[model samples]
Target: MKAGREELMEIIDLWGYSEDAQARIREILESEDVPPPHLFRYYGDRPGKVEQAERLFERTIGTPHALAVNSGTSALMAAIAAAGIGPGDEVLVPGYTFFASASVVVASRAIPVIVEVDETLNMDPEDMARRITPQTRAAVIVHMKGNPADMDPLMRVAADHDLTVIEDVAQACGGSYHGKRLGTIGDFGCFSFDFYKIAQSGEGGFVATADDYLYMRAQSWHDTAACWRPDRYAEERREGELFCGENYRMSEMQGAVALAQIRKLDGYIGALRANKKRIRDQIEERDGLALRRQPDPEGDASTSLVMFADSRELAEEMMAAMRERGVGVGGRFDQTVRDWHVYSYWEHILEQKTVTDEGCPFTCPYYEGQLPDYGPEMCPNTLDLLSRSMHMGISDTWSPEECDRIAEAINSAVSEVLG
Candidate 1:
């Protein structure tokens, strides 16, 4: 029998903030600090929460510099701006990732060239290699669904083409590939601390990088070109032309919650990983299901557990059975009209029109009024994979026993669906 909708909703609500995070937020809010110590003000005199969170993120990600931004979309936009991507530039993006992966490229006034994804649901390196043109300036390698993209080949292709690779680690914080962290491998890595991510602070994002110039550029770009001098708390005005940027700075309150969340990230990842393994062990060898493959066999996965069924009917049957058992199951791509994460749902990008009345990026003389098509015609493999794939979301609060039960539910569901 299937679990009631109300019961299933309760099980899914376990993904956000732990006791520690709540306690920390309470502590920060209760303190009687003057001036609020916001990111808009220099923290040297007050030691703001934003700076504290930035440092913590740097340490956790093993990067030299980490900038806290208002959202993952801002991080991606800043990264592209810092990379000097502008009108007529082309950026390669995975066809199956969150819409922001391509939307950010458009935000940079550049055209996004959609690339196909492999079985791992990551950007296909071979297709990436084939898509390179003289106009290609960069690629955004999204770690979609917490799975790392195959970096070695992606890196090689980037190097061969003299293109910058930005790591979109929005769904993959704390995830790694071949002993290296996902965000640290590329020229720059972006992370999201939004409500549903591996770590959450209500809504916040972080950008990590080892390159000093890129870090400084990202910092300036995120804050509307306000020059940051660590020694001086005030943002120095730029004497020359303005560096392209926006008001994407993270607030002290957001930082407070994110810092606490980062502290618990490792533990949360460990628990989720253990639970994923338990579930995988139970379902991996099932006849009708295929365990999600990873770019690196030994790489660490984030909270989501993915699998593919032999057909769409089999997948739907398994999902129905799991739901009946009070275990939530879902497809890889969101089916809701309000959700616009997948490529097929991005009708805006398919149109390739800018908010500008001039249609500058698309109509820029360098582009000669040309734009790449971003419709289903662009990535057949990604469409096929999404049709047959299903995903199981793991929560940090689930105990070992709950994990076992989830695994049993999956096995049982498979048996009932395929039989």
Candidate 2:
């Protein structure tokens, strides 16, 4: 009989493995040279923890299917491949996201057409609609900074253009739009559990979709060689399923910890929301500045509060003053030379660099129409908004006093800068 994961309950290591590893360091030399055969275990489930986590996402996030991968980038690449998007296909990626968002599209041999974002610092539906062309196959709508994009109009535009919608929910895992979860609303929803994300398992992510065919394709893409998963191995695949792919599967440990983190997702979001509202309420209506315009404020994960100063010089001065007052959470903005989050710093993409000298993706014959006009000035709106923005990171563990102090610092900085 195939062993079940439940069997491990019998020998449950009550003392967690992490602490035991440190405690037993020197004892390894004295341990049994020929260990007893009784220690052998077989988990009938394919990497028990990963599958368990996948199931959790289905139940918690409302996605019909999910595939665990090593990183959010891999999750996106797998999703792109699963959607049958490749050379000659152009995907719309917002200008303000981390470079990886656009790099992944390049990795998939698809052109990433940069789109402008509004003060919300997310993809603008109107701009997205304007960029579509015969070769435009999809849009990777990134819910950046833990807030959902304007999904209602975006989805309508996508539907009108017949564009595949891939929701880059890496930063907005628990965030929602209207009544649906961020990832659940798109054709494929990708999430990240990196150390920096809302709820993390160090470094992990997953791909989610409602379509069975896309789910299978994602599975096949992540596990290219068709390795033995108790589900199947070397079985006849449906047409358009088998192809050259990469290994991006999540480990048992990552899946276990990721599942635990996601289980507490709501608790984290709630604390952050409360903390954010406390600070925003005090300063949002202030003159000489405006808070970020969120389409669904209630559904926001509330990771950060962005305030746009009336001028770029004033915004910088406010940041400096806030730092003096010790409320220095402002970040991931500006045109720093090496900031990976800034698109203008992406020399590799701008220069069209690739693994081989051929620049295969860029030079591919399948590419259609005139290539997009790429330059530092391509996203004027993104640059302007970011320059005038003061980003304050919202924490889940702040005391009431901390919230008030932070709010006071912000108010002081605004007054000092704009007075």
What value does the lDDT take at residue 109 in candidate 1? 81
lDDT of 2 by residue, 1-419 (tens): 53333333222343245545634642563453432222111243244777888888888888889888889999899989999999888999999888889999998888889899987799988898999999899999999898789999899999998999999998898889887988988899998889898878789898999999999899889987767345555555578777878988777667778889979998899899899888888874567788899889889989999888878887878889999999865655666547777777777787788877878688889997577888878888888888788887888999878999999988887788777
Tell me which residue pairs clash in candidate 2: none
Measured against the true structure, the TM-scores of the candidates, in listed sequence, are: 0.86, 0.89
Model 2 alpha-carbon miss at residue 292, Å: 0.9
Taking the tens digit of each residue's C-alpha lDDT, what string does model 1 give over 121-215? 88899999998888999999998887889899999999999999999999989888888888999999999888878888888899899987788
Show pairs that collide, candidate 1: 2-324, 3-324
Tell me the deviation in Å of residue 316 in model 1: 1.1
Off by over 4 Å in 1: 1-44, 225-227, 230-242, 334-338, 368-370
Provide C-alpha RMSD values for all models, in order: 7.8, 4.8
Q: Could you say which candidate leads in lDDT?
A: 2
Taken over the whole model, the C-alpha lDDT of each candidate is: 0.80, 0.82
After TM-score superposition, what is the CA distance of residue 242 in candidate 1 from its true location, in Å?
5.4
